[model samples]
Target chain A: MKRVVILDPLWPLEESADVIATLDVTLDKAAEAVGDDVVAVLAAPEQRVPADLLDRAPNVRLVGTCSTGYDNLPVPELQAQGVTCIHVAGYCDDEVAEHTITLASALLRGVHQLDRFTREGGWWPFPREPRRIRGSRLGIVGFGRIGRLVAAQGNVLGMDVVAYDEYVDEATMRDLGVEKVDIDTLFETSDVVTLHAPLLPETRNLVNARRLAQMRDDAYLVNCARGPLVDHAALGDALIHGAIAGAAIDVYPVEPPPADEPAFGWPNLMVQPHSAWYSPAASLAPYTRQIDDLARFLRGETPVGVIPGGS
Target chain B: MRVICTDDTWPIDRAQATLDRVGATVEFAYEVPAGEDIVGLLTYPGCAIDASILERVPNLKVVATCSGGIDHLDVAGLAERGVACCNIRNFCDQEVADHTMALIYACLRGVVMLDGLVRSGSWWPYPQPPRVVRGARLGVVGFGAIGHLLVQNALGAGMEVLVVSQHAGADEIAAAGATKATLDEALSTSDVVSLITSVTDATRGMISTRELALMRSDAYLVNTARAALIDHEALGQALEAGEIAGCALDALPIEPAPPEEPARAWTNTILQPHAAFYSEASEARSFDNPAEDVARALAGEQPLGLLQPVS
Candidate 1:
């Protein structure tokens, strides 16, 4: 029987046990159980499956991450060792997309500020003037699955959707009914700009001071993708000086932003932990897909959802 | 002609500009003096224009309101004094619709609560699964302009739209791709129920304890219309008892909700300061329309939004 190692406690082990059974495998959550008998490792995005950890499981040929992002896994190193690394992508597209819209809508409509007012027992009819989402321009920084879904929803809300993605062709954008624009124009023209790009070396600090300065004074910024894409100091400063109207951030440069983080207390800023991709339906999709991939690997068919080397 | 504007919150410059175009002089004063030559009286939604106030402005020919609803003004009293009362009805339809969707999204996705968790240094993923807007049933309580726009957007986002309205015909609701539902059916079957109906003798306190009891335990309620349409005390009790999940309210029975408001203690509630119809675009329209109506009233032409007192 094949021995499978599960490193993440949050993994839906019981739900996917039947699939593992079909592969004639015995699953163990103990990392120490990873030995010669282990052929696969099931992990989460936050779990670090480094080279040393992989070295212990020499017989392991497949590493399946039950998440769309594989930044925690060293893909190039795994490829060099002839190990297949797969991640579930496109599982939480709708969830993340809806989250992005929610952030933008909340910021524009002043939901967070108003909520605070109500909680403080402040008088009703506080002088908060909010901008409407309809007839406003929505700028999507990435044109991937999640970005496309946000754009489609923005169109449904009667917003003029514009996007910036170097890799997406103009024809495809037109087909999706989204206007293609350069990054600077998108930042300048959009009333609400959202980031959906992956965190990469080249993409780090993409929303720097210069780009932020180009945004409309009344515009809002929302980040639900990865936090490193935005400069924390610049965002804080911009919000402080009222360079922009407001912001709603779901991801942070550092998880559990330090207690002293100034942005946490900003009246104009709405902060959320990295919980955008979390919905009952979305949380289940990835684990189920990863289990199916593992079953396919055991069948000697090339495992699907393999991350290309250097990506 | 001289016009007396009683609301200081109304845009003075915009109203003045429109009045100038039509060759009318305007004076803005929060207090209306007795025996003034005020040919036109400008009032806001929450401001009272009773018989006493009318008697003060004995020469008042028209009462133009910078709001959609004329509930604050005694329409019968105005008609008895031979005064034309006009309101800006459709100017903020899109704004209210946008705000309604924002509240719905905030409540369903637990955006406000999740933000609080992150701010308090709770970075772990929230254990409770968030509700998704995509396939859920959305019950809209009214089918006015705002309700129609909300229905279109909700349907576009893949939600099943259900509407209950006394004024809208079955064909009109069906043409909008929504099914007609009675108030009980809407409350019982919907995952999210939004109140968009105007407050009236028949509709006031429509969602009290009995009506709330019919809703699902996990469902949410959003109100961007009148606060009198819901019983706040009952809503607070329902939330405390877990009879319903949560609510997002833009209107309260009392503006500047007193510090002792019961709903203020409920964490499941999101309250805004009656700001649903506020947006830069809508604010501009609110001022411009009332000024034009004043101009038309002076010119002996019919005002666009003239209101006739019920016989």
Candidate 2:
């Protein structure tokens, strides 16, 4: 039987274990899968497969991951070892995109406050504040699958959808009917801003104090892409100082944020622990897709989802 | 009796204070993680409450739902076991109605995506997407409290409104500034269809494949009610095939949808995790209003919002 190693402990162990004769392991348990030249390795966002596992599994021709972010994988090592990496990227594109929109709308409409008062039930003796979305400006940071999807939904909300993706040409953006815009103009004009770009060296701390200072006084900011994409300290300070109206965040630089984190202390900030991609429907796609790719790879067929060689 | 609050504060505190005024012991657990049991359960929508949970607390006399919908609890099971079920349904009509319009505007304008792009430094070079909300047909599928609120908001936005509900008359709907139409007519002519109806046998699956087919290709739908009101597969198909422009679903057939459903990956859809009614005012209402019902129930007087006995 062909051995398949799964590096993520939290992957759908029940369904995937049945898909193939497999060696299921956490990142630490990965050594067991390497014996006798395992055919493939399946991974997820949190798992980091070491070089030893790659070297030991000599027959491992494919490294399949259940995540769009393959940064956790040792890509250079895999390339050097002649191993191809395939990822179930963009599987949660819509979920994340949808979440980004939800957070943006919430911030614009003062949802955290609304949630607070609604929980009290007329006890606060204060009239509720009201806001509408018809006149706001929405700026999208990345125009990938999720960004494009958010753009389509945003059009239905009646706000302008301005987007800036460095890799997307003006013509491509126009084709999607999204207006290509400059970063500064977007912040100054937008009533709300949401992030969907990949977290890369260039994008780290992308939403620093200088960029946030350009946003409208009542504008909202959201980051569902990656926590490092925004300077958390700057964002928390912005919320406290009212530099921006509010923020909704799902991803954090640190998971299970330490109890004393500034994000928890920010008055207008709403935080959801890195759970945007965890809807019941979105969670299974990555694992199932990884399994399918492994099945194909084991059959000596090139898996369809392999990331382009250069990427 | 002492009560422990969950992650929410405003409503629970108000209710706790009210109970305190009446000389009942109250203990608020400001942030109870999901699945942990407090001696008394002060519930909120999207918070986990189930039948098996009753086994853990022998002194539990009531399950107070802080929102209009009590489907989160096993009502029949609770009633049969002599546990009282109380829900606050009418307190946040205007607030929720306002949110429905907010979603309409958010979806139409691409507000969420644009906001993210600008603040992330990507908008410095891109143009904003075109957006319009005025003059569009706003269809209200359920002309209840929240629906009525949405009708007024839509009219204020300078849009023609359409109201479709089981109990609405032409004269009453016209008075609300919306033309009365059959569900099919509402689906077809609407630029935006908002659902605010209760989920029932007649209303369940109200918007299925046939109804969605009647919608204009560029039209959108918004639901702030139970997810069972619409057929999920039909909505997914409508979005994927571009049969309907898009949808904003605050509630889903299943909460925290299991990962793997293709719907999670669907583009052009907005999911809100069922929080439209959760303003601070609404939460306070949900908490205190339920107490009123409880007080009445305990007094041997018929409680407001008592579950209707099935025929």
Candidate 3:
């Protein structure tokens, strides 16, 4: 009999117990499971599975991460150990895309500022004039599933959508009703620029000082994918110097960014605590799907979400 | 012809230049003051053009408002004085619709609350559960240009839209991919109810205690149109009793809502100053439209947006 150890309680253990029962496997918490009998370990994306921890379960054959982003997983080390790694992707695509639009809409319409103003007993007709999303340009970086959805939402709002992505072909871009443009053109032409690229070595600090300088003076920037994609210091400086109008950042390089982060005090910037991919539905779906994938793996059938070059 | 602009801060340079080209003199003032025989009164939506104000401008042959709503202008009074009243129609439909959707997204997803929580250092997981907007029901009241645009955007976001409007026929609503429902039905079934109706005797105080009671306790109400459409006192009480989940308001019965307003103390309520129709692009149209209307009035031609007085 195969034993499954869940390193982290991704979802309520009781709710997931029914699904795990189908595989005819006994579920045990990480603390109780020991030795070579444990063939699979389920962990959240935030959980760090160091080699020292893996050494305890030498016979473990599968590691399932309940998240789309695998930055937390050390892929090479796991593959070298002859372990199959799986991650649930595309589960929160709609949630993140909707969040991207939410951030963009809030910034464009001045929801945060106006809400505060009214609460503070300020009068109508804000001191600053807000820009409209309709008939404006929305520039999307990394035209993946979330990026494409954001573009579609922008189109429905009557915005002219443009995008910069190396992988998406021109025909696909046209089919999605997004105009393909170079990075610089996107920054310069867009009324709002949103980042959705995966975190990669080549893409780190993609929105640096030079790129921020290229954006329109009244334009807004939204970052929901990852924090390193934007140079936080440069973005702060750009916002302070009025280089750009405002920014809405959902992900930071560091979770729960330091208290003294400069962007925190800036009136024009809205900082969210990397909760863009979280909703009641989104939080549960990834876990449920991962559990099903784990069940399939245990049944000696090919699982659907296996990461490439992982096994 | 001489034109008196009621708003001193209005960017009338373009309009002034246009008037200059048309051989008309223009004067800007914060108020009309008594005994000013202005040939044309150029005003905005918030300015009160009551009978007394018109009496002050005895020679006011034409009253042109730089907004779509003519509720502030005494159309009957203007007509009684043989003065033609003109307003810009559908100028900021896209702007208001965009703002309405922004508020809807903010309330439904709890973006503002999450932002507050994250800013307060509660980072890893959001304390409040966010509602997914996709597959949700959105009830829109008054399917005019702004309402129709909002419906289109909401549908594009994969939401089921229900519309309630006296003027919109069943066929028109169906054609827009929305179901036509009575006000009571829309209130009870929708996850988010948005008010986009113009303020009139028939529509004023439309969403009062009875209508609010029909809404689900977890639903939200978003109002970007006139504030008089809702009974704020009832809304405050309902929010206190947890009758509705929340509200996002762009306008209030009183501009610069008094400090003692009960709704201000409700944490679940989001209050924005009457700024839904404000944008640099929209502002430009507000000024340009009145300028053109004044020019046309001076030339003895019917203005584009002439409003017929209600009998």
> lDDT per residue, candidate 1, A1-311, as tens digits?
67888888777777877786677787778755357898888788767677665667788888878888776677777777888889999888888999899888888888888788766876434545687787789999989999999999999988899999999999999999999999989999999999999877799999999989999998999999887899989998898888998899987766667898788867588888777898888877888888889889888886678877723
TM-score of chain A of each: 0.91, 0.86, 0.90
- Candidate 1 lDDT tens digits, B170-251: 8999999999999999999999999988877899899999999999999999998888888888898899999998898887
Candidate 1 CAPRI-style tier: medium
As a whole number from 0 to 100, the lDDT of residue B287 in candidate 2 is 65
Cα deviation of B217, candidate 2, in Å:
32
Clashing pairs in 1: A124-B256, A124-B257
Q: Any runs in candidate 2 off by more than 4 Å, and if so which?
A: A16-36, A51-59, A120-129, B1-98, B101-311
Q: Model 2: which docking level applies?
A: incorrect
Arrange candidates by lDDT, descending: 1, 3, 2
For model 3, how does the per-residue alpha-carbon lDDT over B81-151 read when each residue is reduced to its tens digit? Answer: 88889999888888888888898888877888877777777776677567788999999999989998999
Q: Give the top-scoring candidate (TM-score).
A: 1
**Candidate 3 structure, TM-score to reference:** 0.92
What is the per-residue lDDT of model 2 for residues A100-177, given as tens digits with 9 covering 90 to 100? Answer: 666666676654454344333322232334445555678999889988987865765566889988889988888776
lDDT of 2 by residue, B149-251 (tens): 7787777556788888789899998887789988888888888889888877789898889998999988888898888888998889888888887777767
Q: Who wins the DockQ comparison?
A: 3
**With candidate 1 superimposed using the best TM-score fit, by how many Å does residue A119's alpha carbon deviate from the native?**
3.9
